[model samples]
Target: MKERTIFQKFIHTLVDILVLLSLAWFIVYSFFSLYRVSGHSMEPALSTGDTVLIDELSYRFIKPKRMDIVLFQRADKSYNMKRIVGLPGETVIIQNGRIYINGELLETTKISPIALPGLAKNPVELGKDEYFLIGDNTDSSEDSRFQNIGNVHFAQIRGRVWFRLLPLRKMKLIV
Candidate 1:
């Protein structure tokens, strides 16, 4: 009888552990995802081969803000990361290698003057759901300035990149 009681307690503990693990997995699967940075576009912030953790749930509760680093799906269905420069209902233009929004200079330390302004050479208007994105590496990034990538719609954005998880030495919050 003593042996049977011990075995039963062991089984109960095992079941509790399994349940806890399943709950943890479900939370992670529903609220987060991982992405790898593949190009120099977002350099100095996110580098090639850097792994990032994406928070998929926050956007549902809050609107994306300017300067947020986001993971979005391109029209080709490939994923890319970029920083938000212009928000909805804004006019964005690139002149003299600098960015202008609503006829005013958009200043941020993250971006430098870009050599190739792409479609933004002319004033580009953003729709209610559209956002202008650029990479930290202005010269190399293929972003909203170009015709191919264009403005990113809210639906195309997968999640906000909040943390860097890989390359243990470099691990830190991406904010």
Candidate 2:
């Protein structure tokens, strides 16, 4: 029968709580983040009511590239999930169901769903730290094709989409 001091028990409890909270904060801020899918603008790839975890650390070492799924905050303060179609300082043009970046036809096979409808203007130039993103479901999506979401500033991006963690069987890495 050993006796424990009240001060010691309080310290132990406080330490336990702090440890758990620290771990949670690290997990949420660094490696993974939880986001609620807001609209069907990204349907087929993602839908409403889906909770996803974006990997915030990957881009820390490696810069994001074309065709990588990403999560970013819009001008309206809402987060949108989409795939990157053009990189910084590159030209992006969508014409006749084809995408041209830097005057070269971008391979459509790299995109998640084949057959991307190109925009009327081909070879739109990108500014420094600017990237062009688009939703897989282009027809219903307001993406780079439109003036509003056409260019995503590098500062607005939160991180790359790592995986979908909800809806059971549908859960998997975005690829």
All models, RMSD in angstroms? 3.3, 4.9
Tens digit per residue, CA lDDT, model 1, 54-129: 9999999999998999999999999999999999999999999888999999888888679998999999999999
Whole-model lDDT per candidate: 0.93, 0.78
> What TM-score does candidate 2 get on C-alpha atoms?
0.75
By TM-score, the best candidate is 1
Query: What tens-digit string does per-residue lDDT give for candidate 2 at 102-137?
Result: 778877663444355444275678889888888777
Residue runs of model 2 more than 4 Å from their true location after superposition: 1-30, 109-122
Candidate 1 residue spans exceeding 4 A from truth = 1-25
Candidate 1 achieves a global lDDT of: 0.93
Please provide TM-scores, in order, for all candidate models, with all chains considered together. Answer: 0.85, 0.75
